[model samples]
Every structure is written in C-alpha cells, then in structure tokens.
Target chain A: MKLGVSLYSFAGDLQTGALTVDDALRYCAALGCEGVELIGEQHIPNWPNTKISDLDHINDLCKELGLEIFCFSYYMNALSHYDRRATMEEHLEMVRLGAATASYLGTRIMRPAFYGVPVENMIEMIKAGLPIAEKYEIIWGVELHAPFPPVYYIDALEKINSPWFRLIPDFSCWQTAGAAGHFQANDVETLRPLLKWTVHCHGKGHVFDEHGEEPNTPYKDLMNILKEYGYEGAVVAESEGWITNYKPTLDVVKTHFKLLEKYGR
Target chain B: MSVELRIPTGGSYALTEQFRELGERVAFPDLNLHKVEMDGMKGYEFKLRNPWYTEFPVSCAEDMEVGINGYAVQKGKIFFVIRDQAVPFKYAKNLYELQWGLGEVAQVRMLDGQLQAVVKEANDVEIKFLLRTAFEGYHLPNNRIEYEFKRNMGVI
Candidate 1:
C-alpha cells in the first residue's frame, strides 16, 4: 500500500495563510509521501468555479514533485437552502462539478461527504452522477466515518454494486482509543466485509505517543487488515490533532507520516 | 501552626467559569474579526466560518445581530460580502447563488457611521445568527440553531 497525506491535514495552516496550496504539495513531497489527497474547496481557489489554468498549474507542480494525486474529496451541503434542502438537480450539478475537477486533477478517486442528506437521497444523487463519474473515469468513495459502522452502508453499496461506487473506510471507525467518547469503536473485523468496496482510505490520526505512534487508532491492525484483504490503494494520513489537541499541524503531520511508514504495508 | 481551611476555587474551574461567562457574550473567535477598509469606509469586518464540516450557502444566515462593545448595529447597516459583492444583510436570504465554500472566508462588513464609535484598535464584538441547518427546525422546536460568536480582539 502506498502512503500519502491529505491537504485537509493542513487546514489550520491553510486557513491562517501559513501555507499555500503549492506549499502544502511541496511539504507532502518533502515528507516522502508518494501520493496526496486534496479537498477541492480547501486547496482549489474559486472552487466549483475553478480556473483551468490553476488546475493545470497544480497538475504540473505534482508532476514536477513526482507525487500522485490519489484522491480529491468533495463536500455536499444539501441543506444550503434556508427553508428546504437543495434540489436533486442542484446536488447532481455539484457532483458533476466535483467530478470535472477531480478529472482535471488527474485523480481517479473522488470522496464526497453528504452530510445532512439522507442515505436514500445520497444514493439517488450518486446514481444520477454515475454517467459523469464514468465520463471522468472517477470512482466515488463514500467515506465511512465514526458513529456508523461499515454495515450501515452495506445495503446501499450492494444495491449500487458498481465499480464506480465504493467506500473509503476511515481509521476512526476502528479506533480503540483517544476519541474520548465522542465516537464508538467498530470491531476491526467488521471492515473485512467491506474491503472489496474500499478504493481509498483515511488514516485518521489525532494525538501521537512519545514513540511516534497513534494512541487512539490501531494502525498495525488496520494495516494488517488492509493487507490481508489485498487492498493496495493509498492510505492517506489525515491528522485532526490541530483541531482536537491544538497541536501544531506540521508537527503532528510529520509524526503521522512516520507512523504510517512504520505500519503501512 | 493552625491549619486554615481553604475552598479550592481556582485553576481550571475558574477558567471554565470565565469561559462560560464569555461564551454567553461572544459569538465568534477573535481571529475571525478584523478592521478593514471597504469602499473607503473604515470599519470592522467579521468573517463567517462554516460551522459545519461541509460548505453551505450564505443564504442560510438569518436574523443576524451584530454587537460591538455591547451596542447592537442595525440590520440595515450590515452587508454580507461574498465574491466581492456586498448584499444587504436583510436581503441575504434571497441570494441563493452565493456559496460559502468550506475554509473560504466570507465577510460581514459594518461600515456605516454607526460603527465609527466602536470600530477602534481593540473592541468587544458579538455576532448572533440563526443557522437553518437542514430539517432540524422542522422536527424539533426552536432547533433552528442560533450561533453566537464573541471576541475581544484587536482590529488594527
């Protein structure tokens, strides 16, 4: 499995103007990351209305750095309306836009978080965007976050059993420690069944121990499970320590990469 | 020596109490508020941070109230600035096209003469608005959550 870093890990720095998008990509490259993930809105200036020139510049930069753009994450705010949720057409348009951006970034995987939207609505939106996904040669990886087990989306995944539709199981789901009760841990074995559908993954890390290991997540077990299932996709290191513990993101991200190197298969 | 009985009421507990009190008054963080010049009018500008993980439209902002040093500014005097276009706060609800991207900075500028008194080097700022989050309002009573952000920040 290839190890990578998500630009979302440096959200704090990006928001504070401490790091530009170029700076972040270079930082990931310097860390010896073979690939990187990006959140469209976070890294792309004037996102959804993104300029082709900017996209081309980013593509060139990644090529220059020899870093693969593994995945581009998207967020859908279905509740953007004041009195109602966004229409199906609106959501589908967003998907198309996201897919276009992901295609331009030279990434085959797109992870979208449909927060506040029902699963049924989410499925419908994905189904509507399948043509766009196909056209862009992009795969949709629905993120499996905490408080919800992998089984929560099994029926949905089975119903829409297309290669284009898959899962991106976050390590936070298998967290045995460090969440402080905000999330419930799912048995590591539960993820075994969903491995076939997982195209990408989020290696969510919070606080690191003195030994440069994540105290909250079982990285070794997670790596073993992915390896056992023949999952060779990129495991992107995503650090939430900046938001949770107020730790410097650069420091936490560096430690996370080391932890990934130690356990990443 | 006689032992003096002392009630421990300091450290984290005191700090927590102070925060609780401050929480009731402030709406957003100090870093989000800045003093800027817009249209040659010098005043304070407050950035609207997407409270949720995903991006939402600026139209979701409703019933906004801005307080500077304990004085509330009239809604007519406030403007919601996104993409360099400023719309009156009262009419922001009709702007369905203005999307506030995640981690993107959108400003609420109070540049009228009314703010001249409080828009100084350092001031107390408070912003309160009801965020119509999905269908939470339809299912629960008074669940159209009102977000309150407050900070005593340097505006220079």
Candidate 2:
C-alpha cells in the first residue's frame, strides 16, 4: 500500500503557524511519504471556495515535493435543520460538490463523514453523486467511523456495488493497544469483510510512550490484517496526539506511516 | 482547549444563535464558507435532531469540528437552529412551557486531561425550548434589515 500523511494529522501545527500550506507539503516530502491528503477546508487556501490560482499553487507545491495528492476530506450531515427532504437533498449536493473539489485537488478519492446520518440517506447520497463522480473523475466515499461501523453499510455497499461507493477505514476501527483512549475497540474481525471495499485507510495514531511508539493500538495486528488481505492503497496517517501540550504530533504521524510501510503491505 | 467549526460549502449555512454567541464570547476564529451560493437555502431553519456522538471516541480525539451546508442567512441574520443540548429527548411541549422548564446548570470540570461538562440530564423537552429561544436573542451584525421582524415581536 502507498504511505501518506493526512493534513489532519498536523492540525495543531497548521493552527499554530508552525506550518503553512506549502510548508505542510514539504514536510510530507521530507518525511518520505508518497502522498498527502488535504482536509480541504483547513489547509487549502480559501477552502470550500478555493480559487483556481490557489489550486494551481497547491498542485505546483505537490509537484515540487514529489508527492501525489491522494485524497481530500470533507464533511456531510443528515440532521434536518429544515425538513427531511431538504436535508437529504442538501447532503447529496455536498457529495457532488465534494467530488468536484477532489477532482480539482488532483485526487480521485474524497472522504466524507455522515455522523448520525441514516444508512438510507447515505445510499441516496451515493446514487446522487455517481453522475457527478463520473463527470469529475472522482470517487466519493465515507470514512468508517466509530458509533458506526463499516458493517452497517455492508448491505448498502452491496446494493450499490460501485467503485464510487466505498469505505475509507481509519485505523480507528481496530483496537490498537489504545482503543480505550478513543472509542471502544472494534472487533478487528468485523473489519475484515470491508477490506475489499476499502479504497484507503485513515492510518490514525494516538499518543506515544517512552518507547517512541503508540501504546494505545496494536499496530502489528492491524497492519497484518491489511497486508494479509492483499490491500494496496493509501495509508494516510490521521494522528491525534494524546498529549495536551505542543508535542510533536507530526512525529507520531511519521511513525505511523513508517509502521504502515513496514507491515501494511 | 481549541474548537473549530468546519462548515461545508456547496449549500447555504449559518451559525446557531447560541453557538454564534459562544464563538463571539470565546473569540473563536472565523472562517469564510467561500464560493457558496447565498441563495442555497431560502430561509433560516434549525434541526431538532441530535448530533451523533457515538461515532468516535471524541474524548481522546483531536479538536471538534461541526460541518454545515446549504443554509443561507435569512435577511442579514443567520437562521437559528437547535443542536443537541445534551438533554433527554422528548416531543410535543410548547416553547413557553419548555423555556420555563430549563434546568441543570453546568460547570466544566477537567478529569483526566479532558474538559467535561456535567449537566443534569434534562427531563422532558425544556432543553429544546431553551435552545429555541437563543435564536430569539440573536441578529447578525450589520444585518438589521433581516431581524426587523424581531423588533416587531418585542424580541429586541
């Protein structure tokens, strides 16, 4: 699988002026990652409304750094601030827009999260986004998150069975030794079935210990699963440092990427 | 602790009155939800549904970001929407009775390096009532033309 760093991993760095847009790109290159994912709203200049000139700048920066733009992450909601149909329609539009944005960002994959969204609503979103995905040359999918599992979407994925409808498993699904730190440990067994449908992995990492490793989740078992499955996709590190202070969150991210390379196969 | 609101574009969106107040009160940074069609949603609306909290271990996760879209600011004032108020869910209570029913004052307590807000689990529908009224109190700055109805309602 290809190794990458999610701009999300360095959210702290971005907010603290420790890294600029170009700086983030260069950091990933320096770390020897093959690709990068932009949270889109955060790192991209004029996010949610970026100018072509800005996209050009980002494209050029990635080119100079020898990194491929792997994925773009965005958000989707199912709550009806209005009526149900209105909410569903709005979300569907977001899928299309997110896909178009991913195409502009030079990636074919766009990740969206639909917290509390019913599976039915997501299915509708997939159907609505297919045409746009085909038009934009992008694939729109949901990230497998907690409180919700990829399994819940199994029927939906099977029903749709399209490349545009897939899962982006964040290592969040497995119990790294740190399952307690985030959410409860998911049955790693539950994740096996979703592998064939997974186009990318969030490759999440938490606080590290004195041993210079994440103590929360078991990386070896998680990596072995991906490797054994014959999976070969981007393992984009989505680091969340458990330390409160300005700990080098990027270090944890780099470590996660290296671990994936070592075992993610 | 820092909080970030990640409002998505490709639709109309506005901040909740209470959330806007909190943002202003706390001086949270502002971001433009750019290239958006101001006409995405014709009027301001709020969802009574609660946020899905069980999706992730938010306690140990990084900063929280709320996404919004296709909602337009009606008349210069953002339309107020009710978010999950951490209260027990109920239905059918009128706003006035619900307002009078508000209870459970909260204080943020830090336990194990996490910010925890302890509030009494609201019984009945008062939480929604209190939340709905926050909209009664807000008006976007320099957007008086839209909030004129509030002045007529003696809401000021």
Candidate 3:
C-alpha cells in the first residue's frame, strides 16, 4: 500500500500563501507520505485566471524535494443543467489541460465527477468522458465523495466501464456527520472484486475522540483487504486536517505510517 | 467558525420565492442568491436553502479548482423539491440543542441526486430556526447557496 496525501486539507492556507508547496512537501515527507495529490484548482492555470507561471516554481520545488504528485484533483459536476453544452465542453477541456500538466509532473491520475446526473447515467458519463482521458493518457477516476450517494464499489466499477476510468477510493469518505453505523454497515469486502480499478486511495482516517486528535481509521482492516488482493497503488491520505488541525492530522498520518509498516504484508 | 448556505438548482421562480420566504420567515432577510457568471461556461441559477447546515456544495469550476461551502446550481433558480417530513430518526433540535446526539433522519429521494444519500440530516426546524436567528443577529456574510429545486413542484 503506497501512501500519499491530498493537499486539499491544507488548501485554504496554501491559497492564502501561508502554506507553501515546500511546506506541504516537507509535511508529507515528514509524515512518510510516498506522494501527494495536487488540488488542480488551487495550483492550475488558465480556466480564465490561471497564473501558469506560478506553478513553474512549484514543479521545480517538487523535483528538488523528490516528491511525486499522485493525482491531479479535478472534482467537477459535468452533468449540471445550469450551463450550456459549451460549459460542459469547457470544463472537460480544463481537465484535459490539467491532465497534461499532471503528466508533465509525472502523475497519471485526474479525478472528475459528473455531478447532478441520475445514478443510471453514471455509466454514460464515464463512457462519454473517456476520449478526454485517452487524450491525455490520464486515468480519470470518480471519487465516492460524501455528498454523492453511497455508490457500491462493484456497481461503480461497472458504471465507469474502462481501464482509463477508475475509482479513487476515499476510505473515510463513507464517514460523515452520520454515525459510524453508516461506515460499519458498508460492504468493504465486496470491494475486493474491484481492487484492480482503484488507482488512488484517499487515506483519510477519523478518530472518535472529542479532542479530534485520535486516529480512528480501521487501518488494519483496510490493509488486510489491500494485502489480500495484492493491490499496489498510491493510497494518499486525504487529510482530516480541516476537521482537526494540521499537526494533529499530520500526526495521524505518521501513526498510520507506523501501522502500515507494522501490519503491511 | 465559517458558515455557509446550500441551495438546490433548476427550479422555477415560485419555488425560489418559497425558499426565500422560508429563509425570511426564519429571519435571514439579507440573504441574497447571485448568479455565477464564469468565463467559458454556462450560467446556472441557484438560491439559498439553509445557511446553518454544515454540509454545503463543493463547486469544482472549469478552472479545476474546487471550493467548499459553495455550489453551482445547474438549471434554474430552484433545483430541488423541498418537503417537511416527521422524522422518525432522532436528531438535535438546534445546533446547540444536541451537544452529542445524532439528529433526526428525513426520508429523501431514497435513490436520487449526486449523493446517493438516502437522507441528509440537517438540524431540526427548531434548531434551524434558532440558528438562523442567532446568525442573522450576529451579521454574517452569506457565503454560498445551493439549488434545491430541480423541476416544477407541481410536476414532481
């Protein structure tokens, strides 16, 4: 199980310049993250206001630190009634540009979502988005985010229907303001069948402590599943730092690293 | 300590008025829903649902940047159908009402929308009313709104 982190957890500060790319890389390296997921919006340019040159320094900095980008996060709802067809086309093109940048930076995954479509339309959207994915040789994965419905792993894979299309499993995405029952009742075992399609993992952990510093992820269970299936890909910890703070979330990743090292097969 | 409003999109002006009335009835008189005019994209209409609800829409714009506490309502000003159900599941009466209790559950599009969530538990009416009052009194900036109406209420 490879480890990584979605820089989104720190995006607010990063956007304000309080957290630099160096700060994030050091944090990831310190936490033992093998890679980092770049939030394309915070760093990408030209959807009208992109400062393309701003990321030049960032790309150079990543090379110096030996850090790798696991995925280019492009989480958008392509299926909205709000925009005209041109809007959708524009959104997809922006993702293509993002994929090209990710490729240049050495990552192969870019996540996009067709927001607002009926569950039945998931397959069509995934299939429709394929050419764009192929255009960049980027594996476009749809995330099982909290706001979206509880999409089953198998059904999700079936709907996506392509090697170019896949799942970016956020282990903790199932956790919400709702109780642990929602997570406990999930069919994690069923995911074994879809492991091959999982390109990236949102390695988010949530502890039940009121202080918000506890590590409550079922790492052993997750690792056991991954190991049993021999899954090898970037499992980037999407930080709960927004819910907790930076240090605590970083500490949890460190703790997770220790756990993965100890119990990993 | 940041607060936001989520509205559903694609509904008619009647539904939009109802949503606004609901907010004003609970006293967010200053609440205004604006149309987002971004470059190279279609414009969508949306309105404010509830500002007190913690979960707002995450807007991934054409620029590939996604921001929380914001949403892009796809069709019209109203996109979701609003209903009040007698929740069978337990929840807090207000944001302050339940210090540790899980709130009530309202049966939703059992199988509809982006989140396959059967039910999105928001604060109970009492809590929502109270929170709306408290925040309105505190003078908060209306951060974001989601489109809640998707079609003509009479049709759905």
Candidate 4:
C-alpha cells in the first residue's frame, strides 16, 4: 500500500497562493509519500478551465519527484437545482474533462462524492455519468460519506455496472456511523474479500482523544485485512490537518508505510 | 412551477418518492426514478432531523426562463438537512441530465422560500443538526463534523 495526501488539506495554502502544486508535491515527496491525491480545484489552477497540455506538465513533475498520481479528487454536489442546461452541462463536462486529464496522468480513477439529492437520484445521476466514465475508460469511485446509506453505496455501484466504477470508502465515516451502532466499519474481514475491486482508499485521519496521536487510523487492523486479501491499491492518506504539524503526521504515515511494507505482499 | 415538501431520511428512495409526489402535484406527464442497488453503504444510519421537511418543485425553468431576463430562470429550491456525509456527486449528474443547476447563484434559502443572505451560521446549524440526528439514529459515538458548506444556494 502506497501512502499519499489529498490536496484538500492544503486548501487554505492554495487560496493564499502560499503553496503551488509543485510546492505541494515537493512537500509530499519530502514527507516520503509515494503518491499525492490531486484535488483539481485546489492543486490545478484554472481547473475546469485547465487545458490538457497544462496537465501533462503536472504529470511530468510527478515523474520527476518519483511520486505516483493516486487519483484526481473532485468532490462536488451534483444535485443543486440549476436553471440552465448550460450550467449542468458545464458540471458534467468538468467530470468528463477530469476523466481525460486523469487518463493523461496515468490513473483512470475519478474520485467524487454522492451528495445533494436522495440516493435514488444519486444512482440515476451516477448511471447517467457512465457514458462519460466509459467514454474515457475511467472508473467512477464514489467516496462514501457517513449519512449516505451503505445500501445506497452498494446499489449505486451495482447499477453503474462497470468494473471501473467502485466505492472509495472513507473509513472515518464508516467508523462514525458504526460508532452509533447504525452500521459497522469494523468488519474489515468482510471488506477483505472485495480487495481486488478497490481502486484506491481515502485514509481519513482524526484524533479519537486529546492525548491520542494524530491520524489515529486503525491501520494495523486494516493493513492486516488488506494483507490477507492481497489487496495492492494505494492506501492514500486522503485526509486534512493531520499534517499541519507536519512532523507528527509524517511520522504517523511513515510508520504506517513501514507497517504496510512489512506486511505488504 | 409548484412545490411540495416532505421529510425523509437522507437516502435515494426518500428523495425519489418526494420528487414523484412533486411531479404528480405539478401534473408532469413523465418522470422516472432510475433504479439500482448500491453496495458498501457508508452513511445509512445517520439520523435525519425533521425528515419530513423535503421540498418538490412546482415550476419548470423552461417556462420561467422565457419571461424572466436576469430575469434568470428561477430554478426551484429545496431545503433539507444534510449531515457531514460524503459529498453527493450523483445529485449533480441527475440534475444535469434532468436539467437543473443549484439555482443560478448558489444562494441559501430558508424552508419558507426566503433567501438567507447570511446563511453561514444557518448552514452550520443544518450540518450540526444532521450530524446529531445521524448519531442518534445510528447510535454511533464520537463522530464530530469536520466540514460544511455555507456558500450560495446556487450551483457553480
């Protein structure tokens, strides 16, 4: 399992122009991250407006840093009621555009959220997007948010009807929901079976208690599950704030990396 | 356009049912709820607050756009509580295909159809309520909300 960070954690820096995409990648490289999850809006300037050639420049930079591109994160709510087809078209085009860009970046996974409408509409919307995903030979990895029912996640994936399309499970959300006894995130044993289908993962980090270390991810247990199943996707640190105190977060991830390295088959 | 409101938990079936009711109330001839079963449910247990407070559109933009000039087409608004679940992307796909963007300006309006210019606090309230509700509904402990949206009610 390769480790990485989503650019979202650096959103404040991006807006302030304090960090460039290059700078972010450099930081990741410095952290010994094997990859970086590129949130287009954060790392790619002129984003939806960015040209294909511009992205190639980024791909080249990643190669130079020895950093693999994990996925292009585009967390959007597709269900806001809009007045014009032009705007809706623009949003769809953005995804289609990202698909092309992801292809160029040597990864075909487009990470998105299933938000806004109810689950049925979410499924319909996802189904409608198949053409775009298929057109670009890209997989649609819906990041599972906590309020969304697990049934909806499964339903939508099955409906999308593509091996390329799957769920990018946010273990935190799962844990949160299960903490209430509403669902269960602890069943890593069950998830282990579906390892082959997992394109990537969002290793969201958080503090369970004040004294607990940053990114108190149940890493060892998760890694054990992945190891048992021979799952080989990047367990990207798709989180925020864990690295604000860069050293500690880096230590946490690096330690996890070592653990994965030790157990990784 | 006409609008009707209902309250249901945050899931697809509830929203589709509400939409169907709204479409029927407005006399739309054809409306379809695409069917599919999604796996790896993540946030199913999050409780909904006042789940009865769902809205259905009463008008179509095609009609309003012709008469209103900046006067822009009034994309109908629906107000509901959303917990800090995964960001919903499928909603956009459905709306795009169905031809509705989150209004023109992404403004936040109240349940009574009044725009709340200073919606940042109110937006946070929605999120908090949803999270609390989800926790109670699911019986989960220690899932604090980490992010939220307070931007315009319109879509970008």
**Which runs in model 2 stand beyond 4 Å of their true positions?**
A77-86, A176-183, A242-246, B1-156
Candidate 3 local Cα displacement, residue A2, angstroms: 1.4
Candidate 1 C-alpha lDDT tens digits along A115-157: 5124666577777878888888999889877655556677678
| Tens digits of per-residue lDDT for model 1, B3-112 | 12121322223323332332242223345456677667776677664543334556767778888888888778788887788888888887666666654556788876
The TM-score values for the models, in the order shown, are: 0.82, 0.61, 0.56, 0.55
Docking class of 1: incorrect
Query: Fnat for model 2?
Result: 0.00
Name the weakest run of 10 consecutive residues (lDDT summed) in model 3 chain A: A77-86
Better candidate by DockQ, 2 or 4: 2
User: Model 4 over residues B1-156: C-alpha lDDT tens digits?
Assistant: 111212233433332333233222222111211121124321111111111111111111111110111121123322222222221322222322221111111111122112223222212222211111111122122211122212112111
Candidate 3, residue A124: Cα displacement in angstroms equals: 2.7
lDDT of 2 at A148: 48
- For candidate 3, lDDT tens digit of each residue in A180-251? 212232445644655777887775654434433324455657668888888788776555433323343345
Q: In candidate 2, what are the lDDT values of residues A76-179, reduced to their tens digit?
A: 53321211223556666767778877887789898865542456766776776677777887876677654344466776788888887788877665644335
lDDT of 2 by residue, B1-156 (tens): 121211123211132332332222211121221121123422112222112101111111111112122111122232221222222122211121121111111211111111012111221101111222111111222111111000000000
What value does the lDDT take at residue A111 in candidate 1? 79
lDDT of model 4 at position A20 = 60
Query: After best superposition, candidate 3 residue A93: deviation in angstroms?
Result: 1.9
Candidate 3, residues B49-134, lDDT tens digits: the string is: 33221211111001111111233221122222123321111122212211110111112111113221211222111111112111
